[model samples]
Target: MKKIFLLAALIGFSPIFSQERDQIRERDEISPDNSWLKVGITGGVPVGDANNASSFALGADIRGQYLFNPNIAIGIASGYTNYFGKDGFDDFGVIPAAGFFRYYFTPSGLFLGTDIGYGFVTNVENNDGGLYVNPQIGYHNRDWNIYAYYQNTFLETDMDIQNVGVGVTYNIRFN
Candidate 1:
């Protein structure tokens, strides 16, 4: 009876022991290789000192990013932002080319990022390019991103132009 019981238990447990171990998966399942391009549109209000110069802002941008891991991404971005003058001021635009870093919170789809680079002034005479910084927070999924940001440009003329804005992006995955 003891020998029969031992044989029965071993037979019952054999399948469990023979199965392969589970493999670890990447945090973001959307991209196995982790590279993508994002194209988007932005709209917002000119704020603080910028409000006196312009009332509304509108723009479009494109970004290329590589995910170093599940939580971190480094990228380059370029965009055009047009500020509509309030009344007497002439309408102007800025073409911003920036390098950025982003940190994502897993499962929550939330991210924080910052862009630092140059803002080349356009459409208005006598104004020159300047350094700019944009800090942002957003929520993203496999194919979409929605974010809000504050962009500040420190111009050569001692004027600081800033905007409070929201943007939405569609992501295209590569591998």
Candidate 2:
């Protein structure tokens, strides 16, 4: 019985120690890379007055970026968020185009990011367009990302609307 157990352990250990270093490196090179485009779909709950007037918010976004040494990225972003109506007010929606920026902790998956730009609020009454900004914190990997953020619409001389929510992003890489 002792001999059989020793033989089994040696068989398992041998395969690991016997692997060529070059073969491991070659296998790593064959694996898919994380670069290029990231597309995201998000849902948010309205906060403050925005929530009283609307039920929730939903949006979609796209970004193109270059990884500058694996810790930072910058790109452009645009999306539409629909704020559903509740009882008193009508549905509100905005189309925002912005510049995207992100910084990740080196060798870790945590990140902080932001988007800022002009947003046109087309479906609301008695107000013009506004400035759009989103600040977010998230965990990300090569396959997927998850984040929580505050999205704000600041209409000049008028009320500011806030949407707070979480979102998921899918990553697509190109070689």
Candidate 3:
């Protein structure tokens, strides 16, 4: 009876020990490569108050990224958003252009990044310019990606705007 119990314990632990050994081997075999480029499009709802009016903006963004190494990458993105007022006031449009530096934490392509850029907001007749900072979290696979970010818009005057958005992206890899 004791021998059968010992056999059962070994059988249960053999696969777990083998999996740990394989993970150690994988860590030793990882290397950096920089031969791929990915481009994607994303659309989402932007959470913010549009000039004291309770409204959310619909936004779309285009992204281009190049792998400099397995762990580091650089990219650029441009986004456009618009909010319509509830009353007879004018609608507002915003254009944001930014660059990003990304650090990948896993080979499966989970990343965190920061972006800095400027946004131009325009109404029917007047326009204003603001600087923006966005901190983002994202995941990338062979052909699919998703991201979420929070943006802060700082105008030259004292007006400040904050936005939180979540987006899903599909990538086209260039040959």
Q: Which numbered prediction scores highest in TM-score against the true structure? A: 1
RMSD in Å for model 1? 8.7
- Over the stretch 1-175, how does candidate 3's per-residue lDDT look in tens digits? 9999999999999999999999876654423243234434443344545546425656666667766656787778777766656566655666778887778787677889877888777663433868978788988665666787876667776665566777666655544
How does candidate 2 fare on TM-score? Answer: 0.75
Which pairs clash in model 1?
none
- Total backbone collisions, model 2: 0
Models 1 onward score TM values of 0.79, 0.75, 0.67
- Residues 1-175, model 1: lDDT tens digits: 9999999999998776655222223434436357899899999899887899898999997898888777898989989999999779988888888999999898349999998999999865778789989999999887888999999888888688899999998888776
What are the clashing pairs of model 2? none
lDDT of 1 at 43: 96
For lDDT, candidate 1 versus 3, the one ahead is 1
The model with the greatest lDDT is 1
- Which order, best to worst by lDDT? 1, 2, 3
Candidate 1 CA-lDDT value: 0.86
lDDT of each: 0.86, 0.81, 0.67
Off by over 4 Å in 2: 1-35
| Local accuracy of candidate 2 as per-residue lDDT tens digits, 13-80 | 88776677656655445223424677889999999778888988998877776555578877787778
